[model samples]
Target: MSRYQQQSAAAAHVGGAKASTDGRRLRVGVIGLGIGRMHIEGWRQHPQVEVVAIADPDAERLAAVGDAFAITARHASAEAMLGTEALDVVSICTPNKFHRPLTLAAFAAGCHVLCEKPMALSAAEGREMLAAARQAGKRLMINFSYRFSAQSRALKAQVDAGVFGEFYFGRTVWHRRRGLPGFGGWFGTKALAGGGPLIDLGVHRLDLALWLMGYPKPTWVLGSTFDPIARELAAKSGKCFDVEDLAAALIRFDNGATLALEASWAANIGEAELMETRLLGTRAGLLQHNLDEGYRFDAHIFMEQNGAQFDLHLHPEAGEAPSAMHDFAEAILQERPHPASGEEGLVVMEILDAIYASARSGEPVRIAA
Candidate 1:
């Protein structure tokens, strides 16, 4: 058997340590210093959590992050850090390729994991990770950060209140006219990132839409990807770029609902960055979109009352919403379900797999049960 497979099988039998319950702070370790910095900040928000160690393959970046966060226990690899520290939680903020292995390793070490989005390169890998977590009796949460925003939470509250009844169609998109990330690095490499903006940026919007719509089961997908602009740019720079820059898809759900998903790292558009999710329902329609091409977003509800169209703008409550990492820490401390579960991440990965498949086959791909 392969090394990871062996680890996976072993993880099913090894029960990891649970969150501390003796009035002690939870020791946390974060891997991959790039996005791991944010994870550290989020964990610090919880009064019962302390980020004790960090890891990264790049020595320079690792050292810089360690110093900035005042985290003295740092390692050049996850294995070294996991071996040295008795952590209650491990955050896997690595590249797409390392998510599965790191998650399984963390599970084997008896630590709950909070993984970054897209879960892994494929849905199959996501399922394995889920199984490993179940076997270890560990909590596995996905860092679907966008879902923690005030705008998103407000919209979700209304959805739960039945303000938007029986959603039939939804459109979610994240577009960047000239915002290719790490153009010559892993983001542009298909093997490393799994896909371009579709996996990176689109994952957030897709999750937001699905979460608001109660996560309907996707039945089919027809997707297309293009990279003409990225190809030309890569040719000029002489870099290793093999992934699509833009992707669009139409998805059908078993509940007779449909979703239109679009994402692009580079495109001919007015906004430098644009993100929006609109859900059409029987009672009312809801919209959550970014403002001024920036991260701040606004939520709105549209409906007809007294035979007249009306738009109601939503105002978020006073305090700031918790980050996904904060929610993870809270859930573990409270012994409750986290905001974004592994199953939800798996669903997103499955849809992504079908999208890529449909893009390749030039035909609609049916999602397997």
Candidate 2:
């Protein structure tokens, strides 16, 4: 068999590390030790997934995660891992710098890919990833973790049921009091992270809001960003932080809908953190927000009918929503569309790029068709 086809066939055995009863289970490989650990749990939740290999630039981290997961295949770099292991799927969980190259390599290796948020450092890179996935006829999904929240899933159901007639506007915000991650790490560097809080925190909210709005065609974006808090925080730690602490943008879609998005890693908000999304539609308005800055969320639907107003609430049962990882696995098995496909990620990237561009140019940036 061809090497690529052999890899697909042996996916069931995870390169003989473990035997698959069904023999069709997908062999999964994950890169990046940090978020890659989360990806491991995500894939392991499914019955038809076998985590065969993992890779990281740091050998200590590579061995640590591999040991923790009982995975024997470990490599110091993605190139080495891809070359050595026969994998059916690979998760790219590294920093923003490696997203594009790893995704392309995964495609070339005849493996489907699940990439972390923000897709890549730029819209252009996201486009390249999309094209590579398409050219290789491989599935590509982005892990927009927020969409898998029970609150978001329930609100989406309400919208899909026509409870919210026509989405007109939305405001999504995620702010943290002092949550600048890895001050001296790649996240604090503009070159590695692309931007800062907007790309990190705002991307989640933007994706959730845009998904609810049915992926509207954005026409233009006006944005502003600040690095005030990071500056003070970094000086105290004697480190340098070059990215923004806060970012806000107004994006106009061709369907006459507008969305206001704000994100910040270090803000003076009294709360430790806050995350919320409010959507306005012709029939009703919907709200989904976390309580007390915790992960769990509550959702409410507001409707006025026959001169009467009603507020509907949702109490999602535990595990009401399947995780993005689970859904991505199912898509591969069923040969169906992934929940958060690369195309969607690319569109979100375009909006984010416009946001940063607008912030730089101090004017609205038009999104080209």
Candidate 3:
């Protein structure tokens, strides 16, 4: 198997260390110690959760996490950890390709899953994972972290309240200037990451857009992808780069609303990082700009009934909401529905697939039924 595939396969076996805890804490096991560390930290904030185990193939990293968490019983494999620890939920933080398999394994092991997005490498894999979750009667949630952002929630409230009447057109963008990740790591490998900026950064905005639009079904998509930045930079730096550095798509929804999407890891744009979403409606328009600045959003409403034009600017209130991971834990414990479900993630995957297909064929691709 290829190195990326081997790494992904090996990840399945990374096990967790044991922690002595009261039965009141919800036992949890985390796979993929890299970003999984974030999950561990988030879970620690909740008194109801006990991160009983963590798994990763890298012995040094595993040992570091175990030591930091003050836990023993470190295993070298996720399967081993799942086999040994009777966890209530397992957080899967592996690469995009491993999401489905790990989630299925967790469900089969009788644990709910909080997986990082873009859920799976493809829509088909997402469907399979959803089915597995349904059959196992376990909660399956994608880590579409943006959904938990206060700005995003506020925008949703406005949209749902008819503040943005009959929303029609929207634009979402996640752009970076020369921000390639990990040089030749799995992130740059198409086989491992599925795609480049679209799946990684773009997926967040896509899900955000869909969620704001009430998870509208995309009917068709036209997209273009380019790897000019990565390929040229790799040639000069003597690095292995084989993924698109930029991707853009136009999506048409079943409700007749249209969305323009753009994502890039490397662009000549002056912005160090720019992430924003804008929605237009008959009654009003809403925009969230400069995501790095805590995703502050501004809402605009127009009134022109008597030939006198008036524009209203709204600065909505914000709050210190719970982290997405924390919310997932609450859903598991409270038996409430998670905001980012497996099915919602599937829609994002379907749009991604369509974008890829459209890019390859140089034509618009219709969403598959």
Candidate 4:
């Protein structure tokens, strides 16, 4: 079978069937009160779910979020929460370094996990987490929020409908003029966050492009990362920044398709923030980009019909889109495949690993089969 065919089969294996939720109110625990708040929000909105426990190293944060969510079981550490709370699912929303351990802990406690992205610091850690999930027979999902957008799903619908027949080349980018987040907090620390915007922001756009392209196997990657403006800003602000402020990569897939990816937390750009992905395919091309540097976006499909070139813009009706939290619960309930499964998460991690490695070595990194 072809590479895309193999990918389809793999997706089918994950999406086709699953175990069960057993009809009980699925109890949930969330770690990292930062983005973990989103996890709590999604679960609380779900009918058959309960946000029972919350964990964070910061006591104040734990208490504030716990009180905000009406969750009484608050602990200063994930281990404490896991040991005491009876949870059916856990959202590992901690720093990149903590993902592997927290996920393993959740799996050990017989809890399915919905982990925040970049999956783990490295593909090796991702492999371990994926293995633990499989051994425990529990669902594992990565919280790739960019793909959860309604526009993303709408594009996926068109791709599935063969509008983008044989997706070949693409460009995915997210650039910010002066929006370096967290200053020199965990986000700017390489040891804690893995890499800068590449792992933090680029991963989202890269994953979105790959997911839209049916996740073609990446054969090799060439990448470059920069710390130009961030280092200067850090010096001026008295905050030590060690990670890259900008990163870009050229990724080639096994199917001979290629994608160029760029991400930056700071740049001398026209837009304050620019997020976009343009795909060139056999049948049609696509452009999905944020409007006015805001979170909202508009997508257009380009193709020729009856000898006339035209564009088809998509506008998903005003409504809530499916979320990582909702899908995690449903995956546990055997309703659908884990929308962003551990396998897919690992592939994304591998791609990220290759990109960073390439940047450091100043050479293209070939992905191990």
Q: Please name the candidate that would achieve the greatest TM-score relative to the true structure.
A: 1
TM-scores, one per candidate: 0.94, 0.92, 0.87, 0.93
Which pairs clash in model 4? Answer: none
Q: Give the candidate order by descending lDDT.
A: 1, 2, 4, 3
lDDT of the candidates, in the order given: 0.87, 0.85, 0.80, 0.84
- Error (Å) of candidate 4 at residue 199 is 0.4
Which of the two, 2 or 3, has more lDDT? 2
RMSD of each: 6.0, 6.9, 6.7, 5.9
Location of the lowest summed lDDT over 10 successive residues in candidate 4: 3-12
What is the Cα-based TM-score of model 2? 0.92
lDDT of 2 by residue, 134-171 (tens): 67877778888888877888888888899999999899
List clashing residue pairs in candidate 2: none
lDDT of 1 by residue, 1-369 (tens): 321121100112224445455676789999997677778888888888999999998999988988898999989999999898999889998889999999999988989999988799999999999999898888888888888888888888899899888999999999989987656799888899898889988999999999999999999999999999999989899888888899999999999999999999999999988999999999999999988887678899999888999999976452478878777877776566677888899999999999999999999999986
Listed per model in order, the count of residue pairs whose N, CA or C atoms clash below 3 Å is 1, 0, 7, 0
- Per-residue lDDT of model 4, residues 1-369, tens digit only: 321121101231332134465666888899998778878887876677899999998989988997887889999999999999988889998889999999999988878888988899999999999888777877788888777777888888899999879998999999989878767689898899988999988988988898999989999999999998988879899986889999999999999999999999999989988999999999999998887777777888999888999989885463567666876776567555667777888898999899999999999999988
Worst 10 residues of 2 by lDDT: 7-16
* TM-score head-to-head 2 vs 3, winner: 2
- Model 2 regions more than 4 Å off: 1-23, 236-238, 316-320
lDDT of 3 by residue, 1-369 (tens): 222221110011112322233435678898988778778887877878888888888999899999999767677988999899888888898888899888999988988888988899999999899888877877788888776766667777778887777778999998989778867788888888999999999998888878877888899999999998788778887866778999999999999999999999999997877888887888777777663423344444565556786776545556555777787766555545667888888899999999999999999999976
